[model samples]
Target: MQLPGDPRIDAIAEALLADPGDDRDLEAWAGELRISERTITRAFRSSTGLSFAHWRQALRIHRGLAMLAEGLEVHAVSDQLGYGHPSTFIAAFRRVMGTTPGAYADQP
Candidate 1:
């Protein structure tokens, strides 16, 4: 949460939250931030205790959960979140939330 200590990390996090479907990888972020990928990697790990991939996936999972709660269909949420396949989204969701999207959505 506060590990990176670099404003660029914050900017990247904000951008991801705003648009999780952006599938740009670490290199793209490094390029945009005008820093080496290794630098970004170290800063990100120091700040969040998670790699950029994991953190970004977490963000997408949270957003997907929210969208599902709002009555969006599973497939739609998957596509909107840039998952190439519904199963991919489901797998990630299960990994993070310990339940399938449909099951979570069914909870009152």
Candidate 2:
């Protein structure tokens, strides 16, 4: 479903996906794209069906999954994802993915 004349959102999505862990200011993103923060937020919501924060969390989880698949320990994965602590990473991963990193790592 295309929003009428709203392709800026696509750019926002690309930028987000390209750097999932970046905590850059939304205004910076808007400025970089030459669009308003409202426009960026609106386009992001329209494209992802979730707020930018949630989408970023999901992307972090996806990255965590990849790290697990590559045999990295949870601590390493958490650090790689810029998580403040392993416990924080574990909690976030479990909350979003419904499984702890250990369980996910052990899965066939």
Lowest-sum lDDT 10-residue window in model 1: 1-10
Per-residue alpha-carbon lDDT of candidate 2 for residues 2-97, written as tens digits (9 for 90 to 100): 222357766655655665556666788788889888877777677777676676778789888988898899998888776889999999999998
The CA lDDT at 68 in model 2 is 89
Candidates in order, TM-scores: namely 0.89, 0.76
Model 1, TM vs. native: 0.89
Clashing residue pairs in candidate 1 are 3-47, 4-47
**What are the runs in model 1 whose C-alpha is more than 4 Å off?**
1-5
lDDT per residue for candidate 1 within 1-103, as digits (tens), equals 2224567588788777778898888888889889888887776788888888898888899889789988999999999998999999999999999999999
Deviation from native of the Cα of residue 29 in model 2, angstroms: 1.9
